[model samples]
Target: MPIPRIHEIMEADQRILNAFSPEKLHRLGQAIGLNDSTTVLDLACGKAEMLATWARDYGISGLGVDFSEVFVADARDRVRELGVADRITIEYGDARNFSPRQRFDVACCIGATWIGNGVEGTIELLRQSVTTQGLMLIGEPFWRKAPTAEESVEMGFSADEFSSSLHELVARFTACDLDVVEMFISSEDDWDRYVAPKWLTMRRWLEDNPHDPMFDEVRAELTNSQLSYTRYQRDMLGWGIFGLLER
Candidate 1:
């Protein structure tokens, strides 16, 4: 089997888990109109960074769900650290079928749409907890350009997996019967920030656990992955977080 995700090995949640900086994440949240009265439901919300940040900066109230107990625990502490514990709840659970107690003004699945299979299915899931006039937010990686067969499968994706371009991604929203309200696309620098840390973290783990059986596996995977991401994905991927309202 493939090695576990990098976060599984790290102790604390790093900042900006996805290919976006905290500033861009904040802008994306604000562009979607978050405010004190807004209630958000974030699925697969690793470390609850987005919601917790919103709660701190915009006074938004929210609930975040993730499968990682470690991440959830850290998230709860993060909320308390930011003094938004009362405004946000972080739960340890599967995000795929997480049922919220009430509808929310915003429903988000950032960089984890796989929880609902894909973008289309994730929107359907998010809609389940969205108020009538609420917004749905999804962060997905689209193709900046076509990749070779080898490049495509390196990310466990086929050529058909990603939208052809940024324009196609926008069209996908309307096809799903949602209107695009706003968007935040990541730059090449953002991609580096998100991926470079994984390399450092993994290397450190290998050094610290030289005798561990999985050491070589993790090391090889890390080496291959870093090379693949740098050679293909960094150039081919364009990740964007979109804000949508029902049409």
Candidate 2:
């Protein structure tokens, strides 16, 4: 399992500092069709920024579940800050086994769909929370083309494990009885926004706390990742946020 990095950086000002920007958030919201009456079940909702935005701007009511204690607490605080605590509820729990007591109008498992093992598994997991006609939103990665085995390895993916074609992704969703209603593909600029800032954050942290034991490790990893990312991911892989409805 991947370590929860968001939790380690959960501060009021830095809550989503390393994540996507407000423009990206707005685009995702538009892609997911968030509206005033939409009731969302946000699985793996880190800090609940999306949920809070939906509730505050769109007047959506929903529940958000995440395993990270820091994220959950921050989410709660954010809801209070937005004065929409009544519209959203956050819980500390794993998304894999979560089953809400009531159904929702929309079920979303964003970038952290690995909680259900994969995209298909995530859809099955979310079925428990979605109403019969509700939508399922999934955020996933796809390669722009078939990547070389060495390239896949460099990106932290097993050569055969994480490699998937766009056609196969669509086929998998179709096979699972989902109709693709909409999709928002992330551009290279989006990748730049998501990844480039981490280098700066890590560099700043390392410079400020050179005496820390983990400083070298953090610096090395960030440097390596920044270098490898341009070669392996920026030119090769693409990401998308997709919305599916029952077929």
Please give each candidate's TM-score.
0.93, 0.89
Per residue, candidate 1 scores C-alpha lDDT tens digits across 64-162 of 998887777778888999999998998888888788789999999999888878888999999999999999999998999878787777766687787
lDDT of 1 at 57: 91
- lDDT per residue (tens digit) for residues 1-247 in model 2: 4344532531324444323566776776776767878899989887888889879887889999988787788899999999999999999888778868999999988787688778878898888889998999887777677667777667776644543766777888899999998877777887787777777777777778889877767877787778788878788777776789888
Model 1 lDDT at residue 45: 90
Report lDDT per candidate. Answer: 0.85, 0.78
Q: Model 2 scores what on Cα lDDT?
A: 0.78
Q: For candidate 1, what is the TM-score?
A: 0.93
Worst 10 residues of 1 by lDDT: 1-10
Residue 18 in model 1: lDDT: 86
